[model samples]
Target: MAGESEYTYVVDFDGTITANDLSLELAAYYGGTGYREIENKYRRREIPIKEWLRQMVALLPPDLDQLNRKALEWVSIRAGFNDFLDQVREQKSTVVVASDGFGFYIEPILKAYGLLEKIEFVYRNETVTDSDGQLKVINPHAHKICPVCGNCKAAHVVRIKETGKSVIYTGDGSNDRFGASWSDQICARDRLAEVCDEYELSYSPWEDFYDIIKIEKPDLKDCSDISLCLPQGQGIKDGI
Candidate 1:
């Protein structure tokens, strides 16, 4: 086995590890046509992910068990994830999953696949039934003042880096940009790749975790100057 290293992989849960986005699948499955309206707003950048979750959750049914069951039935782990975990374990590197999605189903899905224990931590939002008996989204991981992402993935990356671990942020959504910008290296795909290109951030395009395992660790650099948000500060760029 390779000896332990200073690398920590901060991965996205929805589209990165899974072949499909479970949150989107759940919302579309239960939210009916309303899912498109909210999704379009997020894609157009009119609303941040935090607002997206709030609006999307309202469209979902309040039954958590039913929702989780559907999620378990629909989720498919992407190819190479198991081998990637084995490689990470051999190298003694850390893995953390961060997501801005519905959040309630993450653990259940991971546990179902027996992958939950391999992860060092998971940062995500929660969907709960409010006192009024409505399903609502709660973000304990969000920035106190920043209403951008429900889960501040950038903050998670910054925290890991503070522990002297170099982070490799891997994701496939536009909302992942903030966190990816703070990471030492970025493994981007789909919308996240486009965002990285638009912002002039260097990233490696990947199709699956197998490609991720082959990526070389980059030299640590100060990414704050090019990063989108300041995790230690207000969490968003000016005018955003």
Candidate 2:
């Protein structure tokens, strides 16, 4: 018999994990008008994310303390993440938080909520302040298309597929468009639903992620956390 294919849940941070858009929130909170213009360029793909961010950072006033502090203050993670993850563990499922965003923000945010260690992350790097008082985004590049992401959602989706497992993806913004395209099953909200509609893909709309726990290990609805009971166990997390 074939072994069970591991179930991987790939999630995006910024808009998806957090209830608020951290990038724009940080940009506008500290960067003001300059941030808005660069944001437009990001949406239009007029400039690469690195370049767009470079220009945005240049405009930030030279107040190291202010930028560092404000970076995390305005961002808001979803209300039920802790509960959602608890349920994932209850179901004994593996979870990966993937993004094109920096860890400086991601790491701290997770730490704030005591979730950094519960999952592994694949993402870009943290920010640094150059001696000249300019900001630098220090991170390795992503896949050709992923680099352009507001959060590199698609690259992680591809990585999960390469593992030869069944994947479930979730998100709530245009950032999710590329990632959702490759998912075996998708749960979406806001613009992500719009993206799925345009692409003719099937997706479920979710208001909060506790709904995700209910659907874990898809073949085992209403079963205990370990739903591998032989009756519901056929195919289970194992792929076709």
Give the winner by lDDT. Answer: 1
Query: Each model's RMSD to truth, in Å?
Result: 1.9, 9.2
User: What is the C-alpha local distance difference test score of candidate 1?
Assistant: 0.90
**What is the Cα-based lDDT of residue 55 in candidate 2?**
69
> lDDT per residue, candidate 2, 93-113, as tens digits?
667876544345777778877
lDDT of 1 by residue, 6-103 (tens): 88899999999998998999888878889999999989999999898889888888899999998889888999998898899888888999999988
Clashing pairs in 2: 5-238, 100-151
